[model samples]
Target: MGRGLPGSISGGVKRRGLPGAAKEERIVVLETENAALHLKLAEYQGLAGRSTSEVLQLYSAHGQQQKLQRTSVVTQLHGTVKRLKQDLKRLRSFVLELSKDFQRQSKTYLYQILTAVQGIQLENEAMQMFQIKAFDLEQSLQEVTERYEKEKQKRRALHNSLVELRGNIRVHCRIRPLLPFDAASGHSISEDRQRNFPEKVAYAADDETVLIKCSRPGHASINRTFQFERVYNALESQDIVFADVAPLLTSLLDGYNVCIMAYGQTGSGKTYTMLGPQLEENFAFSIEDESELGIIPRATQEVFRLLSEKPPGSYWVEVSVVEVYNNEIFDLLAKDNYGKVFGVKREVVTTREGKSDVPLLMHETVENAAEFLHLVNKGVQLRVRHPTLVHAHSSRSHLVVTLTINTIISGDNFGTSWEDEQTSQRLNKEVSCTFPQKMRENKSTSSSRASSPTQLEATEKLKKVKTRLQLVDLAGSECVGMSGVTGAALRETSYINRSLSALADVLGAIAEQRSHVPYRNSKLTHLLQDSLGGDAKLLVMLCISPDQKYLTESMQTLGFGTRARQVQRGQLKKKNFPVPSKAK
Candidate 1:
């Protein structure tokens, strides 16, 4: 049994070894097949239809991949086509509606355009009618303007006649614009107050009224209004002023004594209104500044121009310049012992004939306006002027410029000169000795002309008509505190105030019809006796500043002007007298 077991074990070992050999043989066969596949890869270059390439690829068929992809692509293309057809259908509908809207809107706009055209045509026709009406209105306005101008002239004439009959002094107010020195005129102006208040405080309310507006911070506002015969605003030129004053010159030429005086506060343009901005001592009247010429220079020129139209030497004009300083009259044309012209103090005396005269007053006969202005310039050099808080070239004295016109008439063809004075007292006395005798002469002189050449040639009687034109520039009223004057200027202020007060008192007396008109109260009143009391046409010019600093002074000036306008001195008696001509 042992022997048989050994032989079986050997047989089992042989069987196992034989199985191992068979497995090795199968692996060798697989490696050879792989090598052959590698050779096929080298021949085809790892891809089909690549003869020179060496490659090997192994592909497997899917279930339906290409068919599924193509199906998806075709489905997407169908979706796109369906969306395009829907979009085209929507676009066609939108286009059709857009065309209909365009047509509808075009019709609407065309209708509106036609309606606008019709409306424009109607407006054109209406405009033509309106233009015709406007033309008619313009023509009517032109006619009315012409009529108004004519009525204005007639009204002016009638007004003058009424004034002449009533014998009321005409007052004109002039409101000057605010000036720099106006603040200096008043010491009350402070920096804070100046900032609080506006500059212009006074103005012209109308052609005949002056209004003062006193508005201040934390103060009761006050407003004052005044009326006068005429009111000139700041915008008015000196020419406009002269135009109104030229009529007085006509009265002067017609044998009427006329006095034109300027009254106002210091730095209120009184001097500028009278003597002009050329009040300087060395001022030369230039034609370039012709528009700036004030009343005095312009009057001088106008008088000469009027005289030029008269017959040669028919009238001789003698001009005299006088200045009142410290209540004393000084002849500015007076000659000293050295033949040098200086202001010679003169006495103003009331004559027995109720007329005022200045003895030894130098009157220079001027042939033309040039000579007259030249003499005035000389007098201005001698006139007293000092720097004040108000005005830099303030006039400290009153200036009186008198033009004495002598109407010389003799034979019908011949002329006579003023060479004969029967006595030295003739210069001091009027032509007539008494008022009643003057009235008789006034009545008889007119009838005497009818008796004419027969009676005139038999006696060889010559007549001379004398008239006086007095233009006065009064010294401005000033307050000592406001002017800050000292020494001589203080004295001047005192005199000036007193004299102005006296003038106001005289006007009050006249306005009240007092029997005793205080004409002799001051030299100013005494000098202006004829103009104030006697039969003479007097015009008062009230000048005012538009500054609040001068409000008080402006009110006072306006008050004075108001009182002056109320004085009715009886009908103006014509000063027509035939003085016996000097027998040559």
Candidate 2:
């Protein structure tokens, strides 16, 4: 009903262009006239009754009501159209405001994007610059490393020059630190007012001097100062002690006998300085214990390193290990008929040239440092040792390790000549089962002469130049009461004390220029005869303890060192002649 009037009113307004009230009046007049016509037709058809006029009136009233409804519908449609036009105007303004906001946000977003792009470009350039600097730094590091290596080599050469200028004998004193065992008790000390426990009685006054402060009851206090080639304090490291001894290696290769001997009282660091301190009670060594290796291992490594710098195959090395136990010499490397190593009796005979030689000594040729140390470790395992009160494992024998370096040089290099007939007589007296390396050298000499003079000159010019490096670890002097030994150890200790006495006697005689220096009194002195009496470079490393308990023995050791330093041997005589000075 609502849609019908609005649609018809819209069409009527469009067609006739009528106002609202007038359109309603015209619709009512047409309905009244139609009702009257309907009444007349009913009468013509002979169906008119009294109620026909009444029905026509009712029909007119119904039509009049429909006109009012159509009028109200037109009014409502006009108001609705006006309200829709207003809402459309407001919506248009809102859309324009939203568009402006979007434009401002897009502008800000574009600026942020530009800034981020610029920052990324700067970062890329910085990365490239950093890479360039890293490469430059790497190159500089490599250059520094090369210079450091050169400096190390130069330092060794300069120090050896100073050693050569010093003299033939070098005596060094090392004062070890106070140990835990210096006190009578390990964990606690007694409340005695007489003796102070673990006190430092010796000190290094300077780099070359040691000062000892001695005070005895009812005796004038004695403050003694001794000068040595080098005095190392307890604060020094093993490397520092070896630094002074390293120059001797160069002298050994230069055709001179070099001897390094360690002498000290019992509980002193005699074995510790020669070999490293062994923590394990057994004879095994760990792989990571390189820093703990002592003078012997380091010297062996240095020898191989120096040889590596020389021409390949120009030199041969042989090693011999011997121990003096209870005044007898036993070869450590000597084997039985079944090819197993055992102690064998060896005799030290004085040659016609007055040099001592071990004829039946077992000589092992070593190709590298590791092999040499392995053989040494094997021999050390077989050494005789027993635990004492002061030391856990005290070495009861004196160890001697000799390294013989055979160098071949031109005959004209040194004035010494080996006549062909003389060398033959000496070679013929040798036993058949000699060292393989020595046999090879002797056989090479047999093929010396040739038809061509060039070949003969070549053969004769090659003379065997042999030099000896003797590393000796002498048995420590013992205090009978302190060592607390019984049956077997007491006897070994007696022998050790006597041999040390013989060494001191030889030094005393040499200092006084006696007609007869007693070298054959003990086996230790006899074996070291050439080094002590001949023109060999000798270094006696005196290891002492700062413990007040062993003060007497320490003083005796220091006194022995003083005597060794007083012996004025002549300048070193190398196989090759020394460079003549301007005076010559």
Candidate 3:
């Protein structure tokens, strides 16, 4: 099987080999198939790798595109955000401007409203003032018209009365008593003469008759006849003299000029009559209501009483007390040297009603009777005194006390129909006239005047009706022989006598209706000229004493009084006196 087997085997081998070869070939084919499969797988793998690469590339491209798109979107969003922010900024600016505009407009509107309100208020106030002023002016005009009409009627009536009444002289008589002294002791005594006097004594006012009765301790009465007003005692008669002059004092307060003088020999109670008796208490007792009444005290009391009765602003009084020693004027109220004297200078001033004299003197403000008495006492203390044969403590010089009073009279309120209607019409007119002016001016003044018609009428009436009063106390007319003066007192007595003589002459001239009366003869006469015959009511008090020692002097004093009574004072005619020029 080896050799044959070899050949056969070889053949078999060949066959087997063939088969094996075929198997081998089959195996090879399978291997090749497997290799091919492997190669395909590699290809597939390559293809998948390439596909995956392509896909990756595609995804990368897609991612790059997405990134670009996102970048673009973000840029666009940023631009949009910037645009929105700009728009917001612009809107905010617009809103702020609008708010500012609103605020400004609100302020302007408020200011305008406030200004308008103020203007309206001011206009209302002005209108109210204008209405008031108009009413006041109307009332004033009516009052003036009525007063003018009344004054015209009064003037006409006065003119007719003056023509009907003829000028005539009037005469009056006065008497005074003298001081008493004890014959054995040569001292003054206070005694009652009424019991020792005769039962019946003849005294006549027409003949200027006087009867004097004297009484002494353990002695019969002494009777004497004199042409004078008689007083048994100075103390007893002083009050009588004051009573007699009381009416004169009343007239002075009623707008009259009065002059009172004690004319007699020295120690005839001239000082006592003018100044009252000196009291041991407060020197003002005589003026305060002692047993004796003085001329100065009575006059002052009357003046004050009248002043009190009048309205507060209606009356003003000025007093001046002077002493004439040796033809020189000495101011009693002056506080300088006691013996200092000044000359009398008289000036005539023309007032609205008449002419008046301004005497050079010191004026004093005496508010009450006590104050007046105090001034009078001061004057008496300063007066020259000397012991005299006729009497003790006699006045050697003349004392003059003058009172000047200024007054205003208000028109009476008559409730007549005519007056009421006239007043109403005047008020209306005044209101009409003043309304426009008041509106144009400050409103305050217009409002005050326009409120009341009565106030306006009162103001207009106050412009008219001015009056003045004068009261004068002249020095006593004395006889130098009875006064027993020496040196300066003698000279003073001479001057006093001369002045008295001149006064008598003036009275005589006035009595005779002479064309020209010498009023400039002496200071006393010049000062008394208006009081003697002026528009003011006039009164003269002649104080005299009754005693046997002063019989001759009493007669002379009575003769002076008689002459003064013969001088008639004419009615005061309304005279337009010239006012002092501004240049003067």
- lDDT string, candidate 2, 1-584, tens digits: 33355456557765988887877677666556556666777676555554687679888888888888888899899889888888888888888888888888888888888888888889878887987888888888878878876885586456445545544457899998888667653222223312446777799997679998977666577698988878999988878888888878877765678899999987788777888776466754333577667888889998888766544444567777889999899988887889787878787878898888777678777767887777777677778888787777888999998887765544443533322344333333331222234444522111111235644554554556678889998999988776778799999999999999999999899878898999899998998898888557899999999876677788999999988877766556686622112111
TM-score ranking, high to low: 1, 2, 3
Local distance difference test, each candidate: 0.76, 0.75, 0.54
Candidate 3 lDDT, tens digit per residue, 1-584? Answer: 21232244335545655666666556556556666777898899999989999999999999999999999999999999999999999999999999999999999999998999899889889878887787777778778878977885576446434522422222223443322351212223223322233222223323334454555558666565533222233234556656645654555543344555555555545556666666644333355556566666766776677556533433345566666565555666655356343333324333455444453445555456666666666766666655555555556666677766544332343222222445445544443443324333412121012435755654554322223344344445555544545787666667777877887898888888898888777766665666555444444445454444444465677667667655555654332221112111
Clashing pairs in 1: 45-53, 45-54, 45-55, 46-54, 46-55, 46-56
Q: In model 1, what is the error at residue 580, expressed in angstroms?
A: 20
Estimate the TM-score of every prediction. Answer: 0.72, 0.63, 0.50
Report RMSD (Å) for each prediction in the order shown. 13.0, 17.4, 32.8
lDDT of 2: 0.75
Worst 10 residues of 1 by lDDT: 440-449
Candidate 3 TM-score, true structure as reference: 0.50
Clashing pairs in 2: none
Query: How many steric clashes between backbone atoms does each model show?
Result: 6, 0, 29
Worst 10 residues of 2 by lDDT: 442-451
Q: Write the per-residue lDDT of candidate 1 for residues 305-376, one digit (tens) a residue.
A: 766655443456778889888999898988889988888899899888988888777777767888788888
Q: Which residues of candidate 1, in runs, are more than 4 Å off?
A: 1-98, 120-152, 182-197, 217-221, 279-287, 411-460, 577-584
TM-score of 2: 0.63
